[model samples]
Target: MNRKNKIPKFIFYMIALWTIFSTAHAEEIMPKAFVYTEVQNSVPFDQIPWKSRNPIISSQPGFISKTWLSGSGNNSVGGIYSFDSIENAKKYVTKFFPNAVKKQGVAHTSRIFDAVIVEKASRDIGSAHFGGKISTKPGAFVYTEIQVNLPFKNVPWQQRNPIIKKIPGLLSKTWLSGVNNTVGGFYAFDTLENAKQFAIEVFPKTAAKMNAALYTRIFDARLVEHASRGMDSPFFQ
Candidate 1:
C-alpha cells in the first residue's frame, strides 16, 4: 500500500480503538441502578424472615446490594436495592419482587431510578453507596418522592441540601430522579422518631409548597442491619 494511504488507515484504526476503550471505561464506572419498595401495614420486620431470604435475593440477576427497611410507626416493611443495570432493576421490581410480596396481602409501592444521573448530587449529601459514607450512625431512614411537572434537571437538589442538612438527626441521603419528573431520596437519621418527623411533617410541607403529590415512609434502620449486611449493603459497611 502507498505510505499516505497506510498512514490514514492506521489513524482510523487508532481512533476506532480509542472510542471503544472510552465507551468501555464509561460503562465500568457508570453508577448503578436503584430500586425501592415498601409494603404498607404489613408484618413486623422480625416476623418477615428477611435474613433467611438473603440467599434468594443474592442469586437474582444483576443484584448488587440491598438495605432492608422496617416502618417506624406502622407495620410496613421494605427495602432499598442496587442493581447493575436499569433493565435488571426494573425487572426485579415489576416482575420478580411483586410476586414475592403478594403474600403480605397488602399493596406495595416500587420505583426505579438512574443512579448514574444523580451520583454527584447524591454524593454531596453523604450517600453511602456513592462513596459519601460519612455518617454511619444511622438508626432510622426516611424515604420520600414528590411528583412534579418539571424535568429532573430543574429539581433544585443542590439548593435544598443546606436545609436538609440542618434537619435534626440526619445522617446521609441518596437522591432519586425517576421517570415523569418524580424525584425523591432515601435518607438516614439517628432515630426513628427523627426520621418519622422529617417524613411526615418537614418534607410534606415542602411538597405541599410545590403543589406536588408526595410519598413518604419512615423505617427502622437498626432492625434490618443484619439482613442488609448479609446482602452486602453499602450502608452497613
Candidate 2:
C-alpha cells in the first residue's frame, strides 16, 4: 500500500487500540464503595438469635466484602456490617434478615452510609492485632469506637474534633445521634493495634472531658470493608 494509505490506516488502528485499553483500565480500577450499617438493641447478648440468621445473611448472594461484631460488654449492644453494594447491603437487612431484626427488637438504626477504602496498610505489628479469618496485610484495616453519655448535646464541636483527631490511626470520623440513648462517633483506623491502644490510653481522657463513656473495636482490612460515597472521596489524590 502507498504511504498515504498506510498512514491513515495506522492512525485508525491506534485509535481503536487506545479505546480498548482505556475501557479495560477503567473497569479494573472502578471505584468501590462500602455501605456501613449499625444495629443497636436492648436484647440480652447471649440470648440474641444471630446464630441461626447471621450466617445465612452473611452468605447471601451479592458481595459482603467485610463484616465484624463487637459486644458492648454489657446488655446494650451494637455491630457494624460493610457490603460491596448498597443494594446488596440493604437487601440483607430488609429482606434476608427480617427475622433476626425482629428477634433483636432493634430500638434505633441509622441510614446506610457509604465509605471508601482509601489507604490500606499492614496489621502485623500492632498491639491490637488478633489474627482472624482475614488476611494480614500489615495496615490494611483498622477499627475504632467511642462511647459518650447523653444529656451533653450542647457540647462544642471544636472541643470534640480535636479529641477524635488525636487518636492514632484515625482515618476518618463521624458522629451518630439518638441511638442507645446516647450520642457518639465512630472512627476508622489504620491498624487494629493502634485502634486498641488509642481506646485504652487516649479515649478515656477524652470521654471524661466530654462527660461520656468509651467503647471501641478494631479489625483488619481483609475482615473489614468500607465504602465512603458522597461524604468524602477516599481517593482524593
TM-score winner: 1
Q: What C-alpha lDDT, on a 0 to 100 scale, does residue 9 get in candidate 1?
A: 93
Encode model 1's per-residue lDDT on 1-237: one tens digit a residue: 599889989999999999999986445434478889887666778898875789998888888888998887686878898888998998898888888878756788888988878888888888877756655568898888888756668878779988888999998999988855578999989988888788878998999999889888888888888888898777787
Q: lDDT values of the candidates?
A: 0.82, 0.44
Q: Candidate 1 at 19: error in angstroms?
A: 23
Model 2 ranges off by over 4 Å: 1-98, 101-153, 179-181, 210-212, 226-237
Q: Give every collision pair in model 1.
A: none
For this target, which candidate reaches the highest lDDT against the unseen true structure? 1
Query: After superposing candidate 1, which stretches have Cα over 4 Å from the reference?
Result: 1-30
- Model 1: lDDT to the true structure: 0.82
lDDT of 2 by residue, 85-164 (tens): 55665676566555555665664443343322221211212111111112223332233334543432453545556656
* Model 1 worst lDDT run, 10 consecutive residues: 23-32
Looking at model 1, how many pairs of residues clash?
A: 0
- TM-scores, all candidates, are 0.83, 0.40
